[model samples]
Target chain A: MAYSEKVIDHYEHPRNVGALDKNDPGVGTGLVGAPACGDVMKLQIRVSPEGIIEDAKFKTFGCGSAIASSSLITEWVKGKSLDEAETIKNTQIAQHLALPPVKIHCSVLAEDAIKAAILDYRSKRSPAKAAE
Target chain B: MTTATATILKSLAEDRRNAPARPVYLDYQATTPLDPRVLNAMMPYFTEKFGNPHSRNHTHGWEAEQGVEQARQQIAELIGADEREIIFTSGATESNNLAVAGVARFYKDKKNHIITLVTEHKCVLDTCRHLEQEGFEVTYLPVEKNGLVDLDLLKRTITDKTVLVSIMGVNNEVGVIQPIKAIGEICRSRHVFFHTDCAQAAGKIPLDVEDMKIDLMSISGHKMYGPKGIGVLYVRRRPRVRLVALIHGGGQERGMRSGTLPAPLCVGLGEAAAICKREMATEAEQLTMLRDRFYASVTRRLPEVFLNGDEKQRIPGNLNISFAYVEGEGLMMGIKDLSVSSGSACTSASLEPSYVLRALGVGEDLAHTSLRIGFGRFTTEAEVDYAADRIVEAVQKLRDLSPLWEMAQEGVDIKSIKWAAH
Candidate 1:
């Protein structure tokens, strides 16, 4: 499986790799993909008061494609609002990374991480709405 | 820094980047580079001595037949069988198919049962599956956690309906050496035929057909530093083991396999077998030392590195290990200079981890994190050290990027967390 230049670049030098304070009110954490399934991606987003994603970080235990997917999503989400990030499709990521057919799941995981993080952030802001 | 020093460093970095050096090959179980001596011995047969072994009219045919016969003798000598018992096939897959399916179909009237290990090669398992489709009952015996078949279980599995027991001499994935002699004895006592796929063991380990009582054995040329596209199946002659021919036309190889034999590949396999017979002892010792050196270096420097198979009962050239919390494919990418095989699902089209590792009771996560490092006859001490260092470095790098590793270090039980399955 030959990785594209972008995937190789992100794998070799992953961007925004670290953990944010999961307990922080501003930080929304999305942990997706099962470890037993050979991938576990933890993508975190720190939302600003103005509703922008001020910072993003990710840590992934998976193949080069999964790590690259997470790394690329982190970079893409950092400057976007929650709504903008939620609109990011997995196909766009897959196309940009030139991932092969089997590796499209890595991009799907990245998209799921974004949605999960946004949901977690929205829930933290309005507990009543989340309970409903 | 001085401008001159910076210029030199930049050039050196570029030189390193542009260098087309081959990756240090550590996947010998997959295939081996053809030995120079074997190639030299095959060259004459390929060019001037080209003749169909089945053709008996001219000197050309006689010369090719002589080469094929010599190869048969050499291969037979390696496993303590007579030259007449050695039958040529396309490769190990064909040989395995011929041995398992041929024998079962030949004796299908009296016996409808076959026995084989769960950890046998895909070819063997698929052949058994095919036989099952044809109404033959196959008992897929499970192996112990150490990757060895339970001898007691084998004794109980044989019945009057059983015709053959096919087991592998050495595992392709984990490098576990099965007790062929014990299995053979059990089969013999039960009045059943025993077959073993010795592709991974032929040139690396000692095999005796007489002592082990192996009725049918498969050998691959490429796995033992010979050319590809040629293999041997040793059919015991004294007890008169019989099999229906898989291919029929020219009646070559005693009608077991019928095609014009490639004299070049035959000579290559012959020379390779002869070389292995002469040098197996010293070669195995050297490989063991190199393998151990690699294992020691990596394990000493890294934490949570687990060996995947029986440590002492495995082949000297194979080291299958799992770097905890590090995905195997990602680790392979990190160490691009080293060639290795991963048990991770990402390496294959399917999303399942290696069935061989799973059969050995390795956890799914560990199975996804395993790497099979094969050290061959040409591997050097320096190469081993370099590979070990690269592996240690890659594992550390991947571990740092792993959330599970971080959580484990913080005293959080990784299993306690509910992971969303994708």
Candidate 2:
């Protein structure tokens, strides 16, 4: 499948490619997808004291679409409030990348990573809320 | 021109200039470029000599018939079969269908069982599946890790009711050469018809039907540097192996395949077969050297690069490898300068890894990371070096971006952790 120019751009020069300190109270790491499924994306977000995402990083082992999706997500989630980051939909990512139907799952994985990271961050903030 | 149009045109020109050179072709198993010599021989037949080979009333017909017959002889000579035993088909897919389904249907009353290897091409496998719908029992035998059929297992699988055994000559995915001679011996001993799909084998390797006791064989033209849309099915005449006709029409190809043969394509296939027959040994040596050089260069620089098929028993030109911690499609994208096939599910419409690799017990993760690189007659030493360098570079780049690679570097076992399926 021919990748869109945007997908190629992200794949060639992925944004925010590294790991944050998952142990840090400010850092929330989301590891989504599966090795058996041929995609594993580790997306991390570090929140500031003001409850805004200060930094985002990702490492993805997948096809170009999957890598591009995660890279694009890192860029989209950084500098946004947790609520705003949570509102980022897979359709916007898929539309931005012009991902084919078969690759829409990559965008979904990216969306899942965002939600998981936010959930982890919220859970870390309130251990009792995480139990609920 | 308008300012916008002028700017667009200027950028278009720049884009054309900056466009990458044609990707170096390393996927010969998919199909090969037509040989120029074969094209030259086919030129006349396409123009002034365009005549139906079945048309016996005029000079045009006679000349076309002679060309077709000569092509038949050329193909027969390459595989050590009689010219009369050669029947022309559209391509290997059709030939395989005819060989597997045809034989099964012809002997349907006496035998209801057909045996074939799991690693056989989709054509053979799908044909077997279709036969199953027709009430024929097919035994899809699994191959060993080295991608070779167990002769004892094959022998035991054959029953009194089994009429045919279909196995591929060389696997298209991994290039593993099956033991056709041994399989043929068992089939002959047990009174069963043996057929092999030699699409990836015929020109690249030495095949003698009589010595191998092969009753039927399939060969594709494009796979052997010949023109597309032409292939051959070699049926044993001495043993009187008969197959029900798959295409029925104008009573052509001994009434087995009935269609007006394209004279040019037949000649091209013939010329290609003749060239392969003459240069098989020298070309094999050259390809073997190139393949080994490419393999060594990739392995020396990269760790955890596993060869997929049998090292020694594989064809001289193919090297199927899995680069651990790197996704196949991502690696292919990184090496845009090289053309190759990935065994990853992302490469196919169906999100399933290669059945051939899975049959060999290769893990889904490894199978998703596999690439099949093929060297052909036209491949060069420089191209091989360039390909190897690009592969190493791409694998390293992708691995750098891989979380799995990071985990592995930290000495973590990848299999121990539970992974989300999605």
Candidate 3:
């Protein structure tokens, strides 16, 4: 199938692709899934005390669509509160990127990866609350 | 390169100019056009002398039997094997299965171990995999970057119980020629039976069974421009290597493969072998030139392009190239004018990258980016030049739309650019 113009747009000029430091207290590092394909995508976010995502970065090894989706997600997640970022759906990412169904999984994986990262950061920040 | 392709280029130029411009077949490796002479010779068997070769009944059977035997002689002659040693089967897949699993079953009690490579054709690898289910131990040898198996590692992999060693004569993907001669010698010294899936190598390259010391060789009729359902399993008759039958009915094909013989296919295969014997050297030389021209044009135009496998050691008809950050399938999609491949046609339908590439240590990204371009007897200089230039153009167009390219331009090594972990 031909790639959508938007997918091509995002693929050709991906907004965010490099990494962020997980060591920064404000930075929440989310390293997640797919050891089989060896595609390890890290979505790191620097969260404010008020729970606002200050910055975001990601690294993904996958197809053009996967890279674009991860790159696009990091760009979307930045500056939003953790709750706001949590609402970002794979469908939304797919629609924005015009990702086809087969490739939508890459976006969903990225979206799930986003939530996973936020959970990781929150778990690091408030251990009691994370456990609760 | 005249020393390289003089005769081939001269003939190819004439063939392309004279050939018809219809039915644009890109799947040359699948099968080839039947030579008219081969067809004419086999016509009398169908109409005037139709009979079952196995039938000891009458003159009809006698005539048909004679034709079958003659075709058998032609096939045997093509590969330099004795007529009795060559047993015709459906195709190489069956031929490979028979050789691999046949050996497995024969040595099951005496020798439980078998050695093969992961990059083998599905027929061989899957047959070995099936043998594993049946309680036979199989060792999978890995290939180097160029797809060559290390003879030393092969030696180490062999054991007291090792009964068979199956490596393809030439790799279907990347067209890397393996160290079959050395591997054959090693197996000979070890007293292990050596088998080669020469499906790709049989008609393309010069394969001498006696010189190569290949005991049981697998060859496909279609790959050599013969009928698809016919193949030759060259089992050494002098020593008479033992193999258990995979089938159990009618005791046809020496009880190794039991089924009604396909006279038409056998005749077609015989004709193909005849043509191959006459034209293989000249065809290979021409294909080699086309392949080189294809590579040179693409490399000259495209930067950051990589060719997979060893260049010098590769077969003359194959070119496996990777366009970094661009998906091979996507590039193929954009290339409507050209009919080609993303490697062996077997894994073409699967979205998963080629296992051959994975075994060669190529990353999924690169594997997905790879394209396997094959030049056959029919491929021309114009087509090669067009394909090469178009490939560069296609990759550039795709990359220009890739967000990955911007990061690349910004000096962010995609490899070093770590993703923020979730």
Per-residue lDDT over B1-422 for candidate 2, one digit per residue giving the tens place of the 0 to 100 score? 34444565578668968997779999999999987678777877877789888898999999999999999999999999999999999999999999999999999999999999899999999999999999999999999999999999999999999999999999999999999999999999999999999999999999999999999999999999999998999999998998899899988888899999989999999999999999999999999999989999999999999999888999998999999999998889999888999999785556688899999889999998999999999999999999999999989988989999999998999999888776
lDDT of each: 0.92, 0.93, 0.76
- In model 2, state the lDDT of residue A105: 90
Q: What is the lDDT of residue B19 in candidate 1?
A: 90
Q: Write the per-residue lDDT of candidate 3 for residues B1-422, one digit (tens) a residue.
A: 32224454567668988987543344455555555455556556666767887887798778777878888898888778888888889889989998988888987888999999989988888888889999999999998888889888999989999999999988887789987788889998998999999888887887777878889999888787676778989898765688998777898777777876777778878878878888999998898778777778888777778888887887888777877766665566556577777742212224567899888888766776788777787677877777777778878766654435545776867666544432
Question: Which docking class does model 2 fall in?
Answer: medium
Model 2's DockQ score: 0.68
Better of 1 and 3 by DockQ: 1
Model 2, A9-66: lDDT tens digits are 9999999999998899999989888887888999999999899999999999999999
Q: Which order, best to worst by lDDT?
A: 2, 1, 3
Question: What TM-score number comes out for model 3?
Answer: 0.77
Q: For residues A2-120, could you state the per-residue lDDT of candidate 3 as single tens digits?
A: 67777666655667655666667777877654323423456778899999998887765445566677878988888899999999999998898887766766777788778888888
Candidate 1 lDDT by residue in tens digits, B29-136: 999988877877787786678987778899988998899899999999999999999998989999999999999999999999999999999999999999999999
